[model samples]
Target: MNEIVKTSAFIGAQPYSPDEFEAAIRAVGAERYHDKHPFHKMLHGGQLNKEQVRAWALNRYCYQEAVPRKDAAFMSRVHDRELRREWIHRIHDHDGLGEEGGGIERWLVLTDALGFSREYVTSRRGALPATKFAVEAYVRFVVEQPLVIAVASSLTELFAPAIHRERIAGMLANYDFVDDRVMAYFKRRLAQAPRDSEFALNYIKTNALTRAEQEGCIAAVRFKCDVLWAQLDALHYAYVTPGLVPPGAYRPGQATE
Candidate 1:
C-alpha cells in the first residue's frame, strides 16, 4: 500500500474513546473532507475555470443522488413513525414528487446551465472512479450499519452549509457563466443542511447513550468524512497534478474546455 493509505490504515485500527472519536469526527471534517481540498480552495479563492466548476457540479450530482437512497435504507430499518416521517423528508428533499424540484433536479439545472446534456450528467457517464467509490461507500454504510450509526453518518451535512456558501460565492465571482439562478442547488442546501444535520445530531446524541455507542456514532461521521475526502483526492489526482484521468471518464480533450 501507499504511504498515505498505510498510515491511515494503521491509524484506523487504533482503539478510540468516545470523546476522542467525537474529536476525530470534527478533525476529519476539519482536516480530511473536500472543504480543505485544493479544488475547493481554488473554487473558493475564485480561481477555477468554468470547465472545472462544471466538473465539480457534474460529479457532485452522484453524491446528491445517493443521499436519499442511503436515507431510505436507514428509514426502512426504523420502526418509529415520528422519526421515520422526519427521515422521509430527507428522501423527499432529494427525490421530490416528480422532478423539477428536489436536490437531484437542482443539481441537473446547475449542470444544464453549465452546458451539460441532462442525460450525460444523470447517466454519470464521465464521472471519476473515486466519485463512484466514495458515494457508493456512503450508501453501503447506511445499508450495512445499525440504524443509529447510519443516522450519525449523515452528520457530514453538519459541515456542508459553510462549504455550500463558499462554493456559491466563489463560483459566482470566479466563473462568468455562473449566475444566481444556476446555483439554486447550493441556495437550497444552505438552508436545508442545518435542519437535516440538527435532526441527525440530536438523534445520535440522544440515542447513543453508552460511551461505546457514542464512539460508534462518531466513527460513522468520520467514515462519512473519509468518503467525501476520497472523492476530492480522486479529482485532484486525475484532474490536477499527476493527472491520471481514469479510462471511460470524460477528458478535457473530448469534453468542452
Candidate 2:
C-alpha cells in the first residue's frame, strides 16, 4: 500500500536524453495535457452541470484570446524572415483581418451559442484568477523564453486535435444545447492544431541539436502543461468542491435563470 501510494504520488522525474527527447515530448503530451485532465473527462462525459460548462467556456476564452499575442511574441523573436512569415500566419489565424473570421471571433460564436452574452464573454469579467495567471504565464513564456523553448511551449497543440474531436463529438451527441455550428472554433482547431504542431515539432527536432536544448524544449512543454492543468485546478476548486467561487468570477446563481 505504501509503495502504491508512493508510485501514484510520483511527479515525473525521468531525465531526458537528446536522442529520446522527441519521445519524451510525445510522452508528456500523452500524459499531462488537459485532454487527460479529469475535468475534461467529466466534461466530455456530460457530467458537469450548466454552470460548470459556463465556467469552462468563460475561462477558456482567456486562453483563446491569448494565443495570437503569444504567437506574435514568438514570431517577433524569430530573426529568419521565412520563419517569421510562416509563424505570423498563426496570428492571422487567431486575430483575423477584417471582421468575418479569426479564432477569437469563432470562440465568441461558441460562447454566444452557449447563451453567454457577447459583452460578458468579451469583458472576461468573470474569469477565474488561475485562468488569468495560466494564460498570462503562457504569453510571458513565449515572450521571455529562448525561441526554441517558446516554440516548444506550443507543443500542447499536438494534443489538442484529439481532444477537440472528442469534445465536438461528445458535446454534439450529449448536449441538447450544443451543435456543430456552435462548436466551430474547435472544428477549426482540429485542422489548425495538427498543422501548427507539425511545424513546431519539425522546428524543435531540427534546431534542438544539443542535449541541453532538447531538454529545455521538453521542459518548456512541461511548463505549458502545468499552466493548462493549473487552470482546471482553479476551476475545480472554485466551482466543483465546497463551492468556494471567487469574488467577481462567474457564479452558478448568475446563470441559474
Q: lDDT tens string, model 2, 50-168?
A: 77888898899999898888888788787899999899889888998776488898888878877889788878888988899899988988887778878998998888888898999
Instruction: State TM-scores per candidate.
Output: 0.87, 0.89
TM-score, candidate 1, is: 0.87
Stretches off by above 4 angstroms in model 2 are 1-19, 255-257
Per candidate, the number of residue pairs that clash is 0, 0
lDDT for each of the candidates? 0.77, 0.83
Query: After superposition, which runs of candidate 1 have C-alpha atoms over 4 Å from their true positions?
Result: 1-27, 98-100, 253-257
lDDT of 1: 0.77
